[model samples]
Target: MAERRVSAGRRRHRAEWLRWGSLAAAVAVVVVFLLSQGQDIDVSYGQSPASSDAVAEGGAGELGDVTVPSVDEMAALVRADDVVRLPGAIASWDERRVREAVGDAEVRILVAPPGLDEDERDRVRDVDDATVRVIGTEVTGGIYQASADSAVGWRAQFAVGDVTDQMVALIAQLRDRPAPEAVDQFDWRDPDEAELAAVAADLRATGVHVGAGATLDGIPEDLAASAFPDRRAWYVVLPRQPFGEPVPRYGPALAELFPDTPVVVVYGWWIEYHGPHAGDFDEVVGASFYAQLGERLSLYDYPQRNVLAGYLARVTDVRYAGLFDRPLPYRPFDPLRVALPALPWLFTACVAVYLVLSARPLLRRSGAGARTGVNARLAGLTALAIEVSGLTDVSGNPSLTRAIGKLGAAGEALARNLPDRHVRSLLDDAEAELDDTARSLGRADYRPDSYLSERLA
Candidate 1:
């Protein structure tokens, strides 16, 4: 019985140890998984030294005959004047107006001559911190860069014409505002003033601050007004032109106009937008809306008021819904990608549940074993009382004496299995009582008649 009990105890302890080992192994898996996830390194879009080397090697291999302006010279020119027009560059008569509009601001504009080669364009692009830098060549169109944080170089196709008026108008809207107003509409081309005002009123009704103007001359005063306080985004609607005609690239210029906020331009049949929120605008309202507008305008030889109104209404709807506030929809079959961010947390929760389940049975068995041990000890005490009272001797029954001795042996076995110090003391006391009884009964030695002893042997 003792040997069997010892084997059972070893098996229970091994099972308990296995449960703890499993938990440790589960924790190790979570740690390893977390370590494998690693960190994300942010990559900036700004030009770097290595990128400059690559561009020099891959682009315009040799500087050739094209003379490129030095960075020092460009910086000096910008510091001296707000508007610098290099030789052969597009001449704008509105340079004085641009200067007047820019007054005291750090903004600078440099217009490169038409027909500048790639090397010359690259040199102009290399000029940093300029508010507006444009290369006026038709072959590569024109390139403009703004000094804003989210500014990116843009290319616009413009006919060789006096852009001085356009530049002055752009600067006027850009200047004095300090910030972009929400849903400001500029009608650079001829449009119905009443219809435009109606569109603005509808947008205002939807709880957005809107400012609309039909002329470029009124921009400065309108911008200074306190009616429109929210500076967030702007939309420019240019006069509709023929499908194949090359109109001035006002979209890129308008994008540079605000610098900080997104600007959308509806020029002729083309729709262009730029800024940090450009992607959000595309996700909320796609380019298809403008494409359909172009298709509808094709049916009419002249600009229809209702058609334009419908288009403006759509723009108003997008503005009312908050263009940049909406989140982009997830791509198809992208469940795993979306859930990947939360995978570590989900894995931890699953591991915790597994640990709880694994330990529950072990805990229950330990508690049951403790209670059974105490009950067996009490039963053994009852048998010891019967022996002490001389019940078996009074009946003169050998079977009764053997049964009582077996019960006492079973109790001793239970007491040995118990871990409590009090149970051990009870076992020692029971053994002392058995020894006294044995001596009293005329036995030379005390021997417990346990049935398990014979069976186990």
Candidate 2:
């Protein structure tokens, strides 16, 4: 009992601590999260080995293990490389990190995200390649310019060989003015330079091959001429793979354009955040991604906290916990089930309530008048009355008293005159109860409440 009490005390303490600790931890995490939120730092995650039914540890926050890297052959392309590619919407590269990742790379390629108005992404498809890599899925075009500090003169990456001073000046100028004139949507504007040779020579020594993707015809010949070194400069495009072959294979135009160049297929409409209801948030997330990352965008549920953050905590914590113990076991859950395995306490509470309510009335009324055996007192009273009235007792004898209750047969006729059934039931009940009393054979006390004493005395 003491051990159980100690255990109970410990349980209560632990529960209290958890409650308080959780509250404190929650506030701390929130404050810390908010504090760290606007910085360049961002978080990441994946699934757990502990749970089979569990897709991710962060519970509802995780969208399952996915990113551009988790997708098919594209995973190889997402790997760290001198090359940074963009083949989706203007919103796709909106994330500040991704924006920087692409904008600052030795080479960058971009495609328009799907659902673009024909004019919006017209520059992307004009390229001769089989694919057009989408740019920013979650970023707006306005914010993409602001955050990248690459004010509207759009230029893809260029490989350097004999870096002229003019080319160096052009690189810097392109870095400053990324999207040209905001004038011709398909102009594909880039700065022309031949100013710095040393940097270009240094770039070539790295033995890095860099090519970018575009809508082949989209880059106005003027812009392509300015952004790249020569007409020999190349770009990529994407076409739908032939269906029904065992493995989907790239078709002719895809192969013909850049046979020696790295091939990156751009999928604009691929699902991002898929768990249960994936499509619901994708539009807003993919469209506003760039500005949101730059903190220039606001008012949406797809923010890191609402979307990726919860997932980060859920999966990371669960994954981290595995270092100490096997993770919580998993089984499928049915919400509608009346008997859920998680609700054992509810069942126990119901049963305990039933027993308590039932037993209380029994315990409370145990010694009410009937239990005191008033009928035995009435019998003694009747004997006195009979002694006074010259009437016979229960045995049908003209006697004042009789030992033993064979007299009950005689008493039955007299008992019919009584009005209260409760009193009468006492007579029936008393005889059985008499056997149960502790004073069953003890001498009676003649207190007024003690009805059996009067008759015997």
Kindly list the per-residue Cα lDDT of model 2 for residues 1-457, writing each as its tens digit.
Answer: 9999999889856754553343344234334434443546222232432222433323433222222322323424434432335442233221333344335534333333333333333443333231223323212221122222121211111110011222223333445544322221112212123311322332235312122332122322333232222222222222221221121122223334334422222211111222211233323333343322322111111222232222223333333333323234344553524333323333223222322332232334435564333444444543332222222212222121121122232233233433445545544443333322213233234222354454556
Where model 2 places Cα greater than 4 Å from the true spot, the runs are 1-184, 188-367, 370-457
Best by TM-score: 1
All models, RMSD in angstroms: 21.8, 27.2
> What 10-residue stretch in candidate 1 is worst by lDDT?
147-156
The local lDDT score (0 to 100) that residue 221 gets in candidate 1 is 22
Residue-wise C-alpha lDDT for candidate 1, range 110-202, written one tens digit per residue: 767644455666677666645666554211112421211111101121212234434444454556443222221122443355644553454
State the lDDT at 271 in candidate 2: 11
